[model samples]
Target chain A: MNDFLFRLFRNGETRLHELNYLFWECTTRCNLHCRHCGSDCTMGSRDKDMPLEDFLGALDTIPESHRPKGFTVVLTGGEPLLRPDITTIGREIKKRGFGWSMVSNGYFYDEKMHHLLMGAGMGALTISLDGLEDSHDWMRGHAGSFQRTVRAIKTASAQRGLNFDVVTCVNKRNIRELEEIHSTLESLGTPQWRLFTIIPIGRAASDPDMILSKEEMTRLMEFIALKRKNPSGKMVTTFSCEGYLGKWESQVRDTPFFCHAGINIASVLIDGRINACPNIDRDAFSEGNIYSDNFYEVWMNGFKRFRDRDWAKRGICTQCKQFRNCLGGGMHNWHGACEEPLTCHYSLLNAE
Target chain B: MKFFRNILKGAALTTALFVFQACYGTGPDFDPGIEMSFHVVSKQTGEAIPDITIMTRGGSESKWFEVGKTDSQGFAKIYGLDYKHNGIDFKFEGKGVTPKDTLINDFSKNFHEIRL
Candidate 1:
């Protein structure tokens, strides 16, 4: 621990601060499509997998100065593990001195595959586990997805250098089972667990009834509060859940910028398209061609365009009480439904 | 008392050596190089945007160079430029959106977005 602290604070060690965050969605194809997925992962009309050359070209655009000291690049997908070249991509990222992370369903954690990914600088693996086996399997639309996810967690934990976490989407169906899910993850020895409130988009948008009500959301927050105070409790981490909930009640309440999609976090689509946030679909938001444009140029120009918009100045987001914190939520949510304020109730509840 | 004073002196010397090592072990006058990358994307869908223009100017009459297009990841490489003394500008025009410009700085980091 002492050594870790020393390294963390070392002046020359670039790992101290993160300059940027990249969410690289290598492929939109997935084996299981969950009902609450914000990205509509189950949809069949998504872009094809990103080509290897295009992937490399994207990596090549990172400016030397702005490169993160502890650069966190998250490789996401319909199921990132399904991509045949994930190991190779992971290796290349590590070679360039970036911290690597992945968000997957955990259905494909084979021994060889895990080894290859770990070898390529896989720092953190976040597997989605909505609830217990029965609940998770039902939500994911696969009979054995829960079991496979648990196995993947165990396998990842048993590895020498891999850190594992579970991401849960809290909704009406699984709100009652959060405690059980927490306990299960803890028992499995997972290092961390993040709970996100379901954003009504993608499949969930098609079936708004699947979303949790304000009362249910409140209950979930109560549970989170209890878990936070209880050291021995099963809950490991609570990301933006509290804040998201708080923001949901009164749209006018100010909160920290929720979606810095364009500024800090970026998503790379399968066909080489880049987006500012994960919320927007490829068809809705195409900033530039990564293959032919300077990454910095396109990003800066995009930000300027976004900031200069009339809606940016006087949209529903402007009237929002929590504009400080919510910041129009994610762009996709804003673009998807203009009537709503794109605020996450969970985020508002946790506001400091 | 004399022996105790000598021991204290020795301890102080060791502490000084450790501090010196911590500060200067890497190098005495090492200049940390600036190495970073960025991604540019559309605000709505989170996809990469390409073919935008990036230009940098240092003085009043600095020449403008057309930086390369963004890759599949909406990322472009700006290699080995000293950002401390230079002012950078980016421009992009796409369908359904007007042309946009931004002044690049250190705080916003790499990934940028444009809305359409």
Candidate 2:
């Protein structure tokens, strides 16, 4: 039913005129060996951090007209703070009239780094804290990671007008502790708590235990809904925009499930491969490269596959009624090595 | 005076929960049924208003279910609703007060003060 409707309503080749967000994988080096590290980043990743000049040059390649006002370039990595010249990079990014922020593992992010990054015009920071001390330490594969992350949250919270949020990758082990995690974040004065289920990729692919079962996913949805329905005054809880959740669509998140990859979001990976979201397998989704392809041209003219969703109509998506709204869930859910639509909330939860 | 009493009741509820957690080392067990309390007052006079109808729907597909109407004290206690982990959309309608709609996604938050 959905397959026929999609084919009928599908329009001609769509193009992206401007980018709202750009993810620059500044460094591949990470301080922690997380159990579910999607990028498989390590303390000594062979892929060298891209030179600051390379990113700046790519930004320069995009014409001034194409760069939308308030467009932010998100600096992501195995751990962005691991880069020695992170402050300089932030400053450079700001100088180009673009807002800059980063996602970190929160191991090395302290009070000093928080103020330094903010001084460098850093707009926001997203830190990962999976569960309580024990659960967090286990997921991060470090003993004192939980303590440092809490300290970082405190530092960020203390900074007035500083925007920051703690993201937890919900796994089987920590799934039951969500209420405790929420209370902990609220106590820490954190502004937002973003929950995300682990994607079966990279190291996570090797450990099937990391993935949440259908029942757990439903509970996760209910938990998020409960949080939104009865908000914690100290903090706001939101589920990450990962997949289609049907009835839980606007209930759990601020907006319906829309895959922003290659549409409003794009990425320059650690290896300089241009893709949509960094989570998508780099090889399968690379539109072009920063070294060879013109950034603006590739963004505007290329990414035909990402912009169009007709091809995604195969598999379970063909039968799902919410296909028009979800468009086969996030690209990462169905793309790469995924044998099926592993993360469709409607199908997983059996929501009508 | 009534508003102050309602506020005290909410505080007492929180203190009781805290004491319960302190004793048991965990929060209360998950209850299948959700109970919500609303205290609606007039924005201009700060006086309790009555006969306000509170309606709810699980999602767009579900029909709106009128939770109940406010009483003489301008308070309504709604029970016997299954939250089922779905956020419920609530609509408040009454005479002389502006009708308002609020989405309640968190079941933990039960007490709502609406000035209409």
| Lowest lDDT block of 10, candidate 2 chain A | A8-17
User: How does residue A221 of candidate 1 score in lDDT?
Assistant: 59
Q: After superposing candidate 1 on the true structure, give the runs of residues whose Cα lies further than 4 Å from its correct spot.
A: A1-19, A42-46, A158-163, A233-235, A241-257, A281-284, A305-318, A337-339, A343-352, B1-116
TM-score of candidate 2 to 2 decimals? 0.71
A1-352: candidate 2 lDDT, tens digit per residue: 2434323322211232246578888988888989998889898999998999998888887777666544677888888898888877876776666766678888897755664565455666678898999999999999999999998887776554445678898999999899999998999889878888877778898897699888899899899999999986868788877777767766786644556577667788887788877888687779999999888778888887778887887777777677777788878776565456656667877754
Query: What is the per-residue lDDT of model 2 for residues B1-116, given as tens digits with 9 covering 90 to 100?
Result: 43533354368432321111100011112221345678999989989999987776522245554546687999876543234356767788887778988877777787988888
In order, the candidates keep a fraction of the true contacts of 0.00, 0.00
- The lDDT per prediction is 0.57, 0.72
User: Residue A48 error for model 1, in Å?
Assistant: 2.5
Assess each model's interface with DockQ, reporting 2 decimals per model. 0.01, 0.01
lDDT of 1 by residue, A1-352 (tens): 1323322222221221222567777888888978876666754635788876677677667777666454566787778887887766765665575666787888887554554454344666677787888888988989999998898877665543344567777777788787777777777777766666655567887766477766676676567656666746543555442233343322221222234445455666666677755556456566876776766567656654333223543454555564543344555555532555454553444544
